[model samples]
Every structure is written in structure tokens, then in C-alpha cells.
Target: MHTPTTTPSPVPPTNPAALLRAMFDAAVAAAQPARCLPPHLPAAPAKGRLIVIGAGKASAEMAQVAEAHYRRQGVAVEGLVITRYGHGAPCEHVEIVEASHPVPDNAGLVAAQRLRKRVTGLSADDVVVALISGGGSALLVAPDEGLTLDDKQAVHRALLASGAGIGEMNLVRRHLSALKGGRLAALCHPATVHTLLISDVPGDDPIDIASGPTVADPTTCADALATLARYRIALPDAVMARLRSGAAESVKPGDVRLAGHTCTTVAAPRASLEAAAEVARAAGITPWVLGDDLEGEARAMGTTLAGLARQTARHGHPFAAPCVLLSGGESTVTLPTDAAAAANLGRGGRNVEFLLSLGVALNSEPGVWALAADTDGIDGLEPIAGAVLHPDTLVRAWAAGLNPRTCLDRHDGHGFFQAIGDSVVTGPTLTNVNDFRAILITARP
Candidate 1:
């Protein structure tokens, strides 16, 4: 009589934790600013004054690359790049401004204003290189003329909880700001604009990053109004007036003002995800890349993936044992009721939530280990991007008095994983390629 093993049939490398870490690190290496920011970069036009303005998690490094490119090309450059706090990179010619993320703050407001100022007063003789990446929407916060920081923060917080996709979130953002939705490009009207982007949005739409600060947006004010309504996010009275009054739409394609401008994608999630798949293949594990543009709610997404992994374990239909599952994309979480200031509210981002949900579904199935993380090194607002869970996770959690199902119900995966010391913390990677997820499946016979 054979004893039934709790995991999939064909065992992979005994240490799946190491396998997950390797894949994640490979993904990050492919996306590091130093690697991804160079090619899309062009030689600064000869005899043109170089001006750089940017916003995003990777904007600082993007700025660094721009400065370096122009410097090597003998083009003198002066500019400012705003990124989330701790995402700053040092550049001699460019100012790197650190700001708040997911939520706008005073620091970001000031930085956005200063970035606008940097592009202002420019002439046709000037060349403005806009360096952009993910997370810029919050980093590039500059309320229109009369709006206060408080007002912008309130609106942003509401939209985040609204379950809106990046496109919808940015649509509203473009209407309410001075720097987003190509308004920044408008400010540098006479100057020749060149936007070098590191896309974090699915489908790689330049206009979606940081609400496309320098990219044209065909989305109109009416569309913005509809998005807010669809999300049921209430806006301040001033914002309402701006919308009712027909604010300028972001730069649209074919607009002559943008004909002279150029936008290039320097790096993307697909590139990073592919790189990771290669790492897994090199390790002798076959890799199935679901995609790099995945997006959806945290828990539901996990449930779907959990089902797939289990199928591979039970039937090996899509893939055999000794395989790894790979995917990349940004996932959102709707914070649960903060009532009671829930002390056990787990402390992680979508990755943690996904893992917790996976743990519940997997039910401590032995032999399979997995990891999830934000490639930027931070997961949600927490320092840990994600953690690894083994088949015995259920046993371990119960021993620690953590009910995996209870944690999942409360959206407190972060808190639960923290208690287990399973959270993977890699502070401030300075680049965001969205999120990286990998599951290692080994066969048990």
C-alpha cells in the first residue's frame, strides 16, 4: 500500500522557497533602472537646452539615466523627478524629489509644483525629457489653482477604495490636477518633449502612468465625470466645478502640440516576467507564464490561481509536476472595516493577501511552496512585499494561534504573516515592475 503524499505528483527541486526567491530576484534584475532605462533614451538634440521633468516610483532612476545619457551626449541637462519616498536616486544635474504614494501629501504637492516650474519658461530651443514610471500618479500631485492638499488626498483615498482600474483612477486624476493627463506637456508647449516611460500599467498605455503627465489623453472631462460616478467617489465642490466648467482634456493623439513630441517605452512587465521565466527554465523547471498584465481584486485573484495550481498538482493537464507558475501585474485590495482598529489586521499588501488566500485553499498541502512580492520591494504600504508559504503553513499558523481562514476573512494577511515571520522584506528597490508571483509545484508519488 502506498502512502498518499499531500502535494502534486512530480516533485520539483526540494527547496521551492529558494526557487521562488530566485525567480523574483531575476524579475527585479531585468527591470532595474540601470538595465531598462538606457535604450529608449535618445541622444539629446544638439544645441537644445535639456530639461527633465518626471514622476513615478522609478522616475528618480529614470532621471538618473536621462542625465547620464545627455551627459555622455554632451547635452547639458537640468530637471526634477518626483518619486515615492525612499525611491530617490542621486543625480548631479537633476533634482530627485521624494513624495507620498497611494495618497498625495504636501511633499508630493510641492514636488509636482517644482517639476512644473522646471518645465515652464522653456523655449523651442529646449528639449524636455519626461521620465515616468508607476506610482507617479500620487507622486505627481499638484492640485489645480485653488485646491488644497487635503482636497486632493481625500479624493485619491476615495478612488483607491473605489475598486476602479488604473485607467479609471487616472481618468479622474487627470481632470483634477495641474501635472497629469498631459497638462505637464502643455506647460512645456514650445519645447520639444520626449517621454521615456517604464510602463507599469497593463497594455503599456503611456497615458495611464501617473495619469500620463506628459502623454496625450483622449479621455474627456465627461468621461472623468462618469468614472467618478461609476466608482461612486464623491469629489469636493471645487473639483465638481472644474468638471462642470469643462476643464482642458489631456493631450490627445494627432494634436499638433504633441506631433513634435515623442514617447518611448523603456521597460515593462512583460520583459521582466520573461526574464524570470528564463531563470526558472534554467533551473530545470518548466515555466508557464500566465501573463504579465494580470489585474483584479487580491483575494479573488488568489482563489483562481489556487485552483489552477491545485489542478496542476492533481491532473498535470496544463503542466506536469516539477513546474513553476509565473505571473505579474498589479492587484488592488479594498481595506475592510477598520472598526476596533483591528489589532490583528494583517500587515501586508495584495501579495500577502494572495498568499493567505492560497494557504487557505491549499490547506497545508505538502511539497508545494510559493512566494509573491511587489517587484519594487515594497508590498502595498507595508515594508514586506510578500511571503512564502509551505504545505505545512496550516499547521504552523494553527500552532501560532492564527486561523488562516479567519485571517483571510479579515483581510489581515499582512498581520498574520508578520506573526509567522514569513514576510519577505526588501526595502526600497527604487523600481516598480508591478508585482511578481510564482508558485513551485513538485510531484509527489
Candidate 2:
């Protein structure tokens, strides 16, 4: 492992950006497949043509590295993977297609259907390298028969607006998908399916990523229906019927359909968090990782974390101010007001909104700067991953003549942060391991 240079600038027992950055870097490095993919895959099968296929935020990049590794051994493979727009990697052999995410559009529908046909004729000796990641559930949308692309698109819109958790939304997605819930693996059955997964789900469950299209599902149709109901999301008549008809059950694990399968998590949020922690330690600052699989209301989570960070700075309850706090996981945003009904609403993902709320709660405490971002480098539909929040973030917003409360009330963190020039844009990191967060708390130097 390459160690970072340590500058003896005595970090005052209070402020901690350097330490936080180290932990964030470690987490990102841990989830990077460029360092993890080559060794896990078996040699290409002898009797059948190697076929690669997958869908996710990282599928395109995973495919590229997987293909490169095999080709380096003088092996050739042909396949296709669908990734979110602008998430494509440079590919020589495998075809990479970009599509809409969080919702299935015409492009995703076509790409997914095409992927289905590409793997339909595989034989026992053939090998299929399936790359699955966080956004695959929506990106690989092949709704069952009689369901139009619009139908799936409608349900996706509802799910997004519903603030349904990842697990809930994915359960509905698997039921709606023709290629999810092990249907893809079933199609590729008799052909050994080796999956390279970069887990974005809370627990890194293969079945949760992309709705387990290429892995056995542990969720059932009832669970999908219950999730939709729990959120009070109104599904279209056709979608509700599809659920009630009982024809959309996902294949459970231990099913014979997956007798010759393997799903390996080459990377995940935990790996990224640990990686970032190592960076902090090397920087001569202590790192206290809160957790990697945190999930809850974004604003609430922000308040909770901000309190801990403040406590760390003051009481040293969790850790001293000289240490950094890091964590990873997906957070939810429940539409609180009637703003969506009143207007087009604002920009920014859950992470950005969380920071906005946190900044307001922190109230410009000195010597603190924090960054929170989605590792995929895209937050919501925006090209920006997330943003940073310094003690002066709110002050700067006011200086720019922006109303922070109004923005937060309207769920417009992107607009507010952008006005303050705090938005962090790192387009398409070519990987997804959920959200990565670093909070630095330090005393006055």
C-alpha cells in the first residue's frame, strides 16, 4: 500500500479536515475495482464463447476492467452493460450503453431488452461475467408482458417522489422487471454466471443490487406490495394488477435456477469507509468511523451526525476534535411539505440536503468543514456528486443574497449551495458504493 506523506504541522486538538479527507480517501480506495477485479474472475471457459452482461452505476467500468483482465491473458469476451448516462468507461470489445436512472426510459428499456436477447442462447460451457451495482435496479427495466415502458417509468417516478427507501423501491422494481429477481440469471442458466458486484445497497445484498436480476432474490411479491403500500404510493392499475396476479415473484435463493452461480462483492461502502480511515491515520490524525450502512431521513441523520461531531469537539464523547468522523450509506428524503404540488421543486440529492440541514443546525461553529457525496459522483439527477459545508456555508449563502431557510424549506440545497459555490461536481466516478461522508471538527488553531 502506498502511504501518504505526513506533514508535521501540529494539528490543533480541534479542527480536522485533513484527517477527514484521509478517511474518505481510504474508503474510496477500498471500493475501487481497478485494484480488486483481476484476481477474482476465473479463466474464460473453453467450450463456449464468453459473454459479459450487467447493469448498474459501476457495470460499465466493471465490464471494462473484467474484459481487460481476460484479454491480457489472450482471452476474448463479448458482452453489453447499461450504465447511467455519462458513467461509461472506454471499452474496446464490450458495448457500453448509457441510460436514465431512478427511472426507466425508452433507452433503458431498449438496452435491457437487448441484453436479455444477448444472453438467451448461452450453453453450459459459456461464461457470463455479470457486473451489478447500485443504480442497476432502475437502469435494467424490462417490465413484464403487457407493461409499457411508460408504466415502469410511471412507477419509478412515484417511487422517487415517494421517498421510499432503497430496499422498498427495489422490491417494487424487482417485481416489475422481467430481467430482475434472478430472471436474468435464469436466462443465463446452464451458462456459468460469475457476478462482479460493487455493492450500493445497505447490506451489500446481491439480491438488492439491480433487484438481483442475475442473483437469487430473498424478497417476495408480498414484500414488494407491502413496501409500495407502506409508502402510500399509488401504483398504476396495471402495476397493482401485476402485483396481485402473483406472477411477479422473484426467485429465492437455493432455487435450482442458480446452481452454478457466483456473486462476488469486489467493492462496497464499508471498504470505502475503511480506506478513508487509513488515509486519516497516515495523516497523523485519528479517525472515528461512525458506521458504513447508515440509513434514515436525510435531515434527521444530518442533525444526529452534527450533534455527534459537536460533541466530539466539545466533550470528546465519541472522539477528540483532532480526529475525523467518516461514514457511508444511502440516506432518504421524505417530501415533507406540499412544495412538489406547489412548484417544480429544487435540485440536489439526499446528501446535499443533509448537509444543508446540518449546516443550519451547526450554526457556523468555528473550525469545522465537512464534505458529503455519493461515491458514484452523481447525486440525484445532477452531475454533481454532493457538496461541502463549512461553518461559513450559511454565512456565504446569505452573502450571496440567498435565503437558506427558504431553500431548505423547498428542498433546494443544490440551488442554495450552487449560489454559494459549494457544490462538489466530480462527474461519474465510474463506480457506486452509495454515499460517502466526512465530517471534520476542530478547535480554534
Candidate 3:
């Protein structure tokens, strides 16, 4: 009698770096406009001129995809979109303007003026499609009636360094802007407005995305002033007066102009995190999705996750080993107070900072591997997406004469990863769904 044939088991990924990269890639791919936009596109207006206007890191790509979709259906489209510098995508009919991001600039101010003029005289038969995403607030910058671009820039810098959340910051931006906080939709009134959003905020609230340029605002000028006071951000007298006098109020909810406008979120941080979980499952690993709305200090979040990873690996309290824990959202970094100390801090983005902190906390824990990256492929202001950490990360750093704790204290995650050649650089992915983090814990053999 012949012996029964045996099938060999497939080999698991021995290199944690490769596995983590695959997970990050899956997350980014899931948020791409090509994959998410088509399904949510509203039918072309039955009998109106289609004018597209948008701003954000993903606005250019969103516009390009929309143009391609309408073109395939023989529908003509025209309009303009503003995106962060170096994030532009080619679109035949829609003009793509590049401007500074995380900071307001003259280029964006000019673009906002042009975009407002485009929608000003539209009739009831005309349709306006607003493609909004993260970074749109800074990229669509047009200061309020009494404020200058310089004044806005000063306030932006202060808000950024104050450890303020995106919601608080956007509230200030909405009131100080000429086109944001539903004013653009008001300008396009009588024209059917369809807004598509790629949310990067914690709650995916349309009102918070790009400061809700095309959606009604529930926040008021007083709220904006309160945010400034909370953050200790000072503004010019005229700018402050505008808020105090309620002259800079945003278009509030129940505004007649926003009655028929439609807003839809085509892609979001939760969807991207779920996509990464799928990749983990396919690899024969259990997936634990921590959350898509996590927010707080970058380093503290990293340390907290490390503790969970340890618990999962040792006690299996929340999850068993052979699992990957995933989370997505934006985390902030508070710069050092001393100028000398701040100057000494090395270059690194928030994602790398999170990863670096995690590595330190893990302290060479065996069989634990992780990755932290921004879905947009740029962490903070750095060129790299983020980085990966393995059990041997700290050992390798020590061998290289680098101290992980020292690097973390200096806020030099980029430097630490670069020294070890473990930085994950993907250039620009043309999308923004916020940060992605994954920790993989393997079962003991």
C-alpha cells in the first residue's frame, strides 16, 4: 500500500519589515481616489454646466479621477482645484494649483479668489462639485475681510505649536477664512452643490474636514475666539475685532444657501485601517483594530500600545498572539519650550516619533514587530512615510553607538531610523487618510 501524501505548510514571513510594509501599502491603496471615488460619484447634473472646485492634499487626484470618470461618459467638466505643493496630479479640464500646506500662502489666497469668482454667478442650472480633504484649510487660504495673509500665517504658526487638536485649529481657520465654513457653498447658491470628502479628522465630521468649505458650519465667531484664547494665540487688533463684533462669522447650520447641497465621505481613516486588518488576516494573523479616531501625544500613544502588545503576547488578555494590532488617526507633537532645546531637536515626523517611542518602550521584546506611518506617505513635514521597528531595534541602535532614549528625548526619530536604514520612504501617495500603526505579535513556538 502506498503511503498517504503529505502537503507542506507554507512558510510565514520571517522578515517583519516586509510584512509591515505590505500592511501599510494596503492601507494607502484602499484610500486612493481611483478605488474610492467612482463608487460615490453623483450622476452628472441632468442639464447644467459642471464646475469643479476643491482643495487639499488629495484634491488634485480627486479632480483627476472625477474628470476621467465624466470623460468616459462623454460628459464635459471644467473647474479648478488647489493642492499642497508637490502633490499635484494631472487633469486635462480642471486646473491644479499648488500651494503651501500646514501654512497659508499667497498662492492659495489667489487660488481661493479665483475659485470664489468661478462659482459666484452660477445659475440654478449649473452644478458645483467640491472635492475636499485634509490640508484644504491651509491650501485654500483666503483671509477674512479684515485680516491679511500675514496675520493668518502668524496665527497658524502659533496654533500648530500649541498642541491644539485639528478641531480646535479648524474652528479658528473657519472664522478667519473667506471661502471656508460653507461660504463657498453659499457663493454657489442656486447651483446644485455636491461635495466629496476624504476625511482625516478624528470623527469624520464633514464640518471638520477642510473646515467644511462646502458644508454648513455649526461653529460661530465666538467659538473661534474662544479657541484662540484657549491656545493663547494672539491676533491683530482688526482680526480680533472682526471676531468680537461677529463680522467674521461662518455660514451656520440652517443657512438657506446650503439647503440642497449634498456631502459624502468617499474615503476615511477607518476604511484604511480595516484594509490593513484584511492584509493581516490574509497572512494567517488575527487582526485587532484599536481605533480610527485615536488622538493625543505621539510618544504617549506609542508607549500605551507597546504595553498592550506585551499583554497580548504574554497574558492574551485582550488578544492572543499571532495577531496584529492596527490603529489610525492624527497625533500631535509639542515642541520643546527652550529655543536651544528646540533647535537641537533632529528632523523627524510624528509617525517616526511614535515608532521611535514604541521601540524604546518595547526594549527588545522578542517576536514583537511594528510599523507606524502616515497614510499620505509623509509623516509630519518629512519626506518619508514613517518607519518599522523589530525586536532587535534597540540592540541595533546600541551597536551603532546610538541611544534610543536620547533620540526620543531629542525628537529625532528620523535620525535614529536613518542610522539603522529602516526609514520607510514612499514619497507622495496622493492621498490623506491620516496615520497608520500596526503591531504584530507572534505566538511562541
Candidate 4:
């Protein structure tokens, strides 16, 4: 969708890489806590203690922002937040704890326990302010009763490799944890709960962000069990038994304990994409936002997008060139099932995988440039954000004696991009709005 405006046009950047990076920076900046948090914060309760608790890649930065906001108003606050290691921001009133992400670890387990204890015995006069974002399900690990930390870790590992989408994976996570699925909100019962979220999941559903630790869940243990069965993910016998017996059921919607709880989505993928569109408009490019809730196999999505880009570049069917196609959503990467394929799998996150596949499909189509990156600055588990593609990307790879198809087959996007020095690295951005993809097409002269 075009952002209607009457502002005078500025000179557009001629360099494709510079233009792409500027769009990405705008998207990430729009979702930062300092920019999105204040409007969603509730006023300090007159007769209550403000207790802050949270987890995710952005939770620490969120906590820091919340603390500063309240402190400026002279309100006393106390709490703890757990974020991915290296994603923490300094906070004085709220304690910031670093933990593992995309996978659970002992540190996250300990922090989860502390977080649970903090909310215990909170009176109706107390207020629980929860800062939730993506990656929280793993960063805030508290295995359910009768399940050990090791058991949770084992199930998590299986799920990561299962090719399941975020919705299904979070369903399983919510049922298997002590802190997720409104269980944390239940702990803060009697106290008013306020959940502020930066959504990285499709649909921007509060129930799926960080597996909805503070929001009521409509999914059941049965739903989680079905997801596991569909993905053929084997869990510990104890976990299976709990699910079958519904002993692992999450707090459902309409639960009396959650009566006064409120949830707010402060930032989302759509908003970030809109910000990028504005940047594109200023650059004299027609911006088409393809939607912010796309999901499927990453490589397949990449190939499909490549076709669209080609259509626009060659035929100008979608819109006249000098146009950029933008989209945001989480895409699944099904790890290889074959032993040989698995053994040779390369290092990369889903964004790079998508870009690599797109590059191969385009086969160096002239006047087309693209970038695919995760908004949080880290794609999957890699240190890099994503990669960029130019018309000569494949040509450069071939010149280096690298086979793009072979690399795609082995899931070696990181290797391929790195070999050609095209990987986009931004370290930790401390915010999560999910993936960002943009394809720029210039009119053939």
C-alpha cells in the first residue's frame, strides 16, 4: 500500500545496498522499545507496588524503557526481566538477566523460578507489568511439575528440528511450561496484570507472543499433542502422559483468575513494514506491502517471491518499475531428514536460506536487487541478520567456483553469502518484529 503524502521528494540513494539497508534500519527503529513503549504503559497504581517481569530478545530493553518512564514520574518500581544473552539493556529498577534463546538452558530455568517467586503473594493492590516479545518461550523456561529441566530441553530440541511453524511450536511450549500460557498471569492473580508486547508472530496474536505467558490461552493440551504427532516429534514419556491426561493444560480464556488482566500490542510487523514503506516512498519507489502474516517453508516462499520480482521487473504487471516489494512474517525451515543431508547442513538462519533460494531462482535477473533479514538483527541462531542479492550475485558465486544450487541443497546459505561477502550483519538489535524482505526493481531502459 502506498503512503499518501505531499512532502517534497529528496534525492534517492543510487546504491542498491544503501537503499536496502536504510529500509531495514527504519523497520527495526520503528519497533525499538524507546520508540514504541511509552504510549502503552499504564499509569502507576495509587495503592499498589509496581512489579515488572518479562522475557524475550527485547524484554530487557523494554524493561529498561518502562523503568525510565516510571522513574521520570517519580514512581517506585521493582522486578526482573530475562533476555537472550547479549541482548540485555541496562536497567536500574528492574533487574536484567541474560539467558539462552531458541533453546533453554540452566540459566533460563533459574531465572524462571525467580520470576515465579517474585509474583507469589502479590496482593490486589500490586500491579504486574509484563514485558513480552519474541524468543521469550525459550528465554523464560520453567518446566511443568514432574518435568525436569533436562526433559524440557530434550523436547525443545526435537521441536526446533521438527519443521513446525511458530503457532504449533508455541502451542507445545505453552502446555509444557510452568510460566507460559497465562500461568504467570495466574500467579499474579488478585493483582492487576498489564502485558505489553512487541509481536513477532503472524496475526500479531497476543496468545502466541512468547507463548502468551500473561494472556489467556484458547489452545489445549490436546492441541499441543496433535501438533507433536503431526510433526512426529517424540517427547519424553512423562511429557506425553501429561498431555494425554490434560495435566499440562494451559490457563484457558474466561478463567476467573485472569478477569482483570489487560494486554497491549505496542509494536508489530505491520507497523515496521509501514515504516519501511515510508522510507521507500521518500526514495521515489512505489512500495507494495505484500502482507505481514505470511508463513510457510522459507525456501519455497523465496522461490515464489523470486517469480513475483521477475514479473514486475520484466513485465511491470504488479506496478511500474522502480518499485519495492515488502513483506514480513516468520517462515519455517524444515531441517533435513536425510542423514547425509543433515550431516552436511551449513550454518545459517532462515532469512539467508530464503535469500539464497531467491537468488538461485532469479539466476541474476538484471535490474533486480533484494534483501531478506530478520528485524531483530539475528536470523535464526546466527550472528548475522540476513543477506542481500544483486543481479550479479550468482555470477559472483560462479566466478568463485561456488555452485548456488548445491549450496541451497545443503542449506548452506551462510557459506554461500559469506564466500561472496554479501552477508548483512547488524549484531543484536534488541527488538523483535520478525522477518523483513524487500525486492527492488528498476525499469529497463
Residue-level lDDT tens digits of model 1 in 21-111: 8888888888887888777776676676878888888888878877887788767888888888888889998988888888989998877
lDDT of each: 0.80, 0.80, 0.87, 0.90
Model 1: runs farther than 4 Å from truth?
1-11, 337-345
Error of 3 at 411 (Å): 1.7
Q: For model 1, what is the error of residue 415's alpha carbon versus the real structure, in angstroms, after optimal superposition?
A: 1.3
Tens digits of per-residue lDDT, candidate 2, 75-160, equal: 98899999988889888999999999877788998898899899887888899888888898888989886688889988888887
lDDT of 3 by residue, 147-169 (tens): 89998888787777777788888
For candidate 1, the 10 contiguous residues with the lowest summed lDDT are: 1-10
Provide the RMSD of all predictions against the true structure, rounded to 1 decimal: 4.5, 3.2, 5.0, 1.8
Q: How many backbone clashes does candidate 3 have?
A: 0
Q: Model 1 — TM-score against the truth?
A: 0.93
Q: Which is the leading candidate under TM-score?
A: 4
TM-score of each: 0.93, 0.94, 0.95, 0.97
Per-residue lDDT of 88 in model 1: 85
Best by lDDT: 4
Which residue runs of candidate 2 sit more than 4 Å off their true CA positions?
1-10, 13-26, 336-344
Ten-residue stretch with the least lDDT total in model 2 = 1-10
